[model samples]
Target: MAVLTASFFALLLAAAPAKAPNLAGTWRGGGFEIVLKADGSGTIKDSEYSPAEPLKWKASANALTITEEDEPVAYSFKQDGDRLHLSGGDLDEPVDLVRGAASAKASSKVDPQAAPGSAAKHVGPGSCDGACRHYLKCAGQPALQAQCVLACYSEGYGADFMGWFQSLDCVAAITVIAMLEAQSRGLQGGGGGGASQSKECEGCRWDGSSCAWYSQGNWGSNVAYSGAVITCNSSCCGR
Candidate 1:
C-alpha cells in the first residue's frame, strides 16, 4: 500500500487544569465501564472483548488508557475535570468488523468545558508547508521523475507497470503523468480524508447523505474510495 505521510489528528486526553482523583464510579456509555480514583487508577470494563479472557488495557498516559480485545476493541479516553470524553480506535480509518459487534471511534473531540451551546474544537499540527511541501513541488521533473520511476519500479511501480509508462522514454513524460495524477486525486487529502462521506454536498453543502460518483471540479464524491457508498456531492459525484 502507498504510505501517505501527512499531518493527522492524534487522539489524546485533554490534561485537566486541575488533577485530583474523583474518577471512580461505574461510568458507562460508549460500551465500557470507566472508573477513576484518587490514586489515578482506572479501568474500562469490557465484557465482549474476548470469551474466557479478561479485558486488557494499555495506559497511554497517567490519565489515558486503551481497553479492548477484539477487532473493534480499540479505544482511548480522558477527563476534563467533571466531563468525561472517550473515543475508539477506528475513528480515522474504516473498520469492517461485525456490525453489532463493530465498535468504532469518534471523528471529533470532546471538550466538556464548552458551554452547552458551544461548538467543537480540534487540535494538532494543521498542515505541512515547509520541507515536505517543497519536495513534492518539483517531483515532476524529468531527471527526477526518471530517477523516481526507476526507483519506484525497482521498489515496485516497475514490475507492475507493463505499459509505455515503464519505458525509459517516460522520463520526459512528466506532464502526462502529472495530468493523470491530477485527474485521479485519489491520495490528495492524506490520512483518512478526501471524499469520505460529508454531511452536506460541496455545491450546496447540504449535509446530505446521498453521494454520487466522483467527478472533478471543486467538489463531489472525491471520497468514494473510502467506502463512501453515498458521497455528499451536489449531484453525488456528478460535478
Candidate 2:
C-alpha cells in the first residue's frame, strides 16, 4: 500500500508543469508596447493611438491572461533567446517583442547612414518612385492619394521612407500602391457586387443611391433598392 502511494505521488510530481518565466519588463513590438510588473499587472501603450490602459494579469506555464474592465484576454507565449513571441488575445497577427533595453543597445550598433527601419540605403530612381507615380494615377485625386501613400509608406517602412522605397521590388511597390489606393477610396473588394458601402447605412434602410448595397437576409424576404439582384452574406452586409 505504501509503495503504491509513493508511486502515485511520483506520477503527480512528474505531471506538474514547470514554472513560468518572470515577464516583468518592458516589451516592445507591433507599434505597441507592454510593461509588465512582478505583481501580475501591466499596461499596454499604443504608440499611434490612445493612452495606456491598466490591466490585471496572471501567468500560467505556457499562457498569460489579462483582465481589463471585467473582460479577460489571453495570449500564448514562447521565449527564444532575447525575443518573445506572443499569439492569440486581441492581436490579429502574432506579436514579437524584444526587451526594450536590449533593443536600444542593438540599435546603437547599426550604421548611421543606413535608414532606421529599412535594410537598403539607396534605391534607384525607378523602384518606389515609379510605384508611387502609378499609385497616384490609379488613386484619382492628387491630395487624397498623396496622403494615403504617405501614411502607408510610413507604416510599412518606418520614418526612412526613401530607404524603404529602395528595398521594394516592382511587384511589392505596386501591391502597396494598390492597397493605399483602395484605402483612400474606402473600397474593400470581395463578396457580392457593391460590397463596399457606407457604415451609416448598415441597419438603416438602403435608400436608392449609387453608394448603397443590399443587406444580407433571406432571399425575397426583403429588398433594399428596386431592381437590385445581389445577395451578400451577413459577414459583409447587415441583416
Candidate 3:
C-alpha cells in the first residue's frame, strides 16, 4: 500500500507543471529567520540580532541567492529537503524549518569559537547545566536512559504533537580497579627475591610479555627486600 501510494504520487509529479521554485513558508536556521509569503516576496531576519533589514534573494538551484544589506554580498545556498545552507558576510549558519512544530530540544556539543564567548561558556548563560544523559550515573554503576514519549492530538488528529524521554536503570557494571591498585602497592614490600628487571613496557611492568598477570610496582620493596633486592641489569650472570 505504501509503495503504491508513493508510485501514485510519482505519477502525479510526472504530469504536474514545472515552474519557479515556490519557497512559500517559514525557514529558520541557527540564528536567522526567513518568511516566504504567497505574494512571491519574502523577508529575512538575522539571528544574531542585527538591525532589522530587508533581504533580496534570487532562487537559482534550490535556495535563495541571498543578498544582505550589510556590505559583503554574494551568498551561496544548497537545499536538502527542508534544510537550506546559506552563507554570506560573516553569516555561516544554515536555515531550518521550525514553524508550527512542537517544542523540541536537542543536545549538541557546541564549539567554543561558535558561542558568544568562551571561558564562562562551560557553565554560564546558554550553557546546559544539568547532568548530561550521555555520561549520567543512575546509581553506583551505569544507568540506562529510558524515555516515555507523549504525543498529543487535536480535533481528529489536529496540528499539534509531542514526544519525550524517560530514563530507567538497566544494568550495573563492575569497577574495582581502585581497590586493586591499593592492594598491589601493599604487596610490593614483601621480599620474594632478587627480582629480574621488568621488560613489560606496554602498560605497567609485567612478569613476561606473554603473561597476563602483570607484576606489581615496587613502591616500598627497597626497604623490605633490603639486600634481597638486587640491582637490576640485563643479561644476568646465568641469563
Give candidates' CA RMSD values in order. 21.6, 20.1, 24.6
Candidate 1 lands at a TM-score of 0.21
* lDDT against true structure, model 1: 0.31
Query: Backbone clashes per model, in order?
Result: 12, 0, 7
> Per-residue lDDT of 89-135 in model 1, one digit per residue for the tens?
53322211111111122212212211111111112221222111112
**lDDT, each prediction:** 0.31, 0.51, 0.33
State candidate 3's TM-score.
Answer: 0.30
- Residues 96-206 of candidate 2: C-alpha lDDT, one tens digit per residue: 677768856654443332213221223433233433433343333333546656665565544344445434322333444443444335444433245344432233343
> Which of 2 and 3 is ahead in TM-score?
2
lDDT value, residue 18 of candidate 1:
38
TM-scores for the candidates: 0.21, 0.41, 0.30
Candidate 1 positional error at 139, Å: 54
Candidate numbers, best lDDT first, in rank order: 2, 3, 1
lDDT of 3 by residue, 1-239 (tens): 99999999999998887666655566654434567666645675432222234556556444455554343255566655555556543332432333323102210222212221111111211101111121122222212323200111111221111000001011110111222333344346345333312331122222332322232322221211111111222222222
Q: Stretches of candidate 2 above 4 Å error?
A: 1-9, 15-17, 106-239
